[model samples]
Target: MITISVCMIVKNEEKVLERCLKSLKPIADEFIIIDTGSSDKTKQIALKYTDKVYNYEWQNDFSHARNYSFSKASKDYIYTADADEVIDDTNIERFVKLKKAMLPEVEIVQMKYTNQLQYGTTYNYETEYRPKLFKRVREFMWINPIHETVNLEPVIYNSDIEIIHMPVMSHANRDFKQIQKVIQSNIRLSKKLFIMYAKELFIAGEDKDFLEAKQYFQNAIENETRGLDEIKAAQCVLTKCARLMKDHNLLLKNSLKNFADNKPSAEVCFELGEYFFEEQDYVEAAIWYYNAAFETECELNIHYAGDYPLKQLANIYQLLGNKELEEEYNRLFSKWELPKSPDA
Candidate 1:
């Protein structure tokens, strides 16, 4: 079996640090924790695991702190996680197997990042498959201050392992702060940064920032021919911004072309249906809403493609006096148990 070094950077995480360390004690070949000026007993807890605990002064850059943590690993493979992250038994087995079978040429290993559950709930878990394990000798480095990421070499392998994140509490304040800091910085905004800023603003519920995000998104649409996913996401953000602004005419005007251009996404169709419903054109609203629900249901059956909008369809049907359809949608809504609010 390949030896694995577990590395982490922490501060004021006394509450969660112990749980995180305990989860991996049995699996890890080595454990290293770098405390970035913890005023709490975080370091004390870390010392129980290994002498690899070191002090790293806060430099206002996550990359700096993480790179320092990486320097201490001496195993064949390096694994890292936040104080709030955990690994389950199944993934532990997968990790062990992957380590045993992995070749030296593998620079990085991407594992599933299981985030939230139910797709839309506020307190629900969020999950995504991400690169978490690394080949130590490959010398993978960390990048970015906020929203830091591991810079991996081109040749990589994916492991069917996972990292589970379980926060002691919600992160709304920190989420907004990160974005606000980025926005306030006197730095040039790349297309990616623009998108990030926009999303943060949207999440922060700032209308002015959302409009700025829309402008950046428009610029992105004008400049790029590729990145269909980002473009589509931006278009959707713009659609929501329009809805929030209650500019029905503008929402209809800007989104109509895209709705017609792409095979109508459930979200897009629902927006159009909403616009028409507000206009008291129930027939058109019903048509668009029905199509939206049908497409979503089909996609859901084929793949776990849609959520919440399925419930919205039920709500719209309730408005349209369709008892049978409403009942059917209600059944699905209960089954999925998606968030009651879109913001959730």
Candidate 2:
């Protein structure tokens, strides 16, 4: 059986650090904890488990801390874990079995990261595969008989083990601050970060947060280098920002751009529904809400398409004195569940 080192970077995690360590103790041959300026008893709790606890200054870069933690692992494989994660008894047995029977050629192992939707964070899915384990040292291999070439791609294995995520609070506020800092530093956000920023704003941002992000997304709308999806994401952010700020001209401009594409997102449709609803135009609001719930796909929060617009439609029908439609929409809203996949 191959040995495994569990490596983690933590800060002010005294509440959950011991619980996570106890759950992972059975499978870990060594524990490497890199504390990034923790004022709590997190380091003390970690020292009780292993002597590999080390302190690292907070660099505002999670990758740097993670790399430092991985560097301390002396075992055959490194298992990356977080303070908010836990493995139940059933999965612990599965992990032990995997360690004993894993193929030598497999350089990376993916495990199911579950319980995401419970916190209503940035993620849309409840469960998804994430790379959790990796071989500490890589071996280069030559392939092909005639023309020898080095194998570049790492062999990946998908495991059935599941890690339960149990965070005490949503990290959206902290993430927004970090994103703002990145933007203020004049660094261009990558396509992935741009999408994540937009999704987070829709999921958990308040009016002030959206307003602060207004200029950045407005610039994104005019930037020709961004892809179609990025443009749509930018429009979604700007539409909500405009609505919150009560800027009618800006709202119309962004909403019309989306309509011209013939593929408005559910978020934009819902914003328009809210705009009309506030103006007491019940009929127009109902039209936009219906389009949101039935016609368009959601780019950010799934609730905009699922329960959010459905609830609005029910309310609009009730205001319009249509008992039949009101009851129908209420029933649909109650039965609506978040889709397992984004495409669903």
Candidate 3:
């Protein structure tokens, strides 16, 4: 049997610490928590789970903190999670068997992170695979001061494990002063890092931040060396920025035009649908929206694929007074393999 240690770095996470640790307790053999100057009961709560908790002064460099956490692990494998992330109860059994069944040759394990980004009563989700689990003794190392990830891409085992991120609804944790400080500290702006900088600022939900977000995203898109996924993501962000600024000209002309030039992505397709939908061009909008929901060779399934397009399609078909067409689309929504939204 293979042993797995769970490594985590936290600060002032008292609210969700117990929730995260509780779910992981049964699975992890070694729990290493590095608390970076928390004033809250986070350290005390961590001690309830393991005496492996240690104090580290707050550092703006995330990779350094993560490397410190990894260095304390004594198990064959290391799995990392955020204080706000929870492993699905359904995935626990599979995870255990996977731990035992994994071959020694496996260098890394990729698992999905489910981020539920809420907008009012409507909930939208975004998912991405990350190498959250890996062999502790391998040649793996983390990089980056913000949004750090392991550097090596050795033979990877794609696991069914999923971590659901449940962030508090309050704005207290929204401040990114520490991250900004690090960014301003002469960090080299790689394409991925650049996108994260923009995303963090854009998520701040201020007028000035949105403008900066637009500028950064446009710059990221123009760089041309980013991966397909990152480029697609930047395009989507630019589209959102255009919409927020109410710059319909940029939405229809600049943002969408730049994205369409590269590839046919579900994200750009969905935006096109919204563009035509607002103009009351139901026929054109429906065409683009259908591609967004059903197109297989999109930039990525999650890139443009979500419950939004399906919901919009049903609305459009119903608007056309075609009950039969609406039912056909409704069936697609009901039968979607991935988790569907409540109203979708």
Tens digit of lDDT per residue, candidate 2, span 129-181?
A: 88999999999999999789999999999899999998888888989998898
Ranked by lDDT, the better of candidates 2 and 3 is: 2
Cα lDDT tens digits for candidate 3, 76-194:
99998889889877878778888779998788888876664532111233555668888888766788999999886677887878778787653412344544465458565665565
Candidate 3, residue 128: lDDT: 55
* RMSD to true structure for each model, in Å: 7.7, 1.9, 7.6
Q: Which prediction has more favorable TM-score, 1 or 2?
A: 2
Q: What lDDT is obtained when candidate 3 is compared to the true structure? A: 0.73
**Model 2 compared with the native: what TM-score?**
0.95
Hey, what RMSD does candidate 3 come out at? 7.6
* lDDT by candidate, in order shown: 0.66, 0.92, 0.73
The clash count of every prediction, one per candidate, is 11, 0, 1
TM-score, prediction 3: 0.67
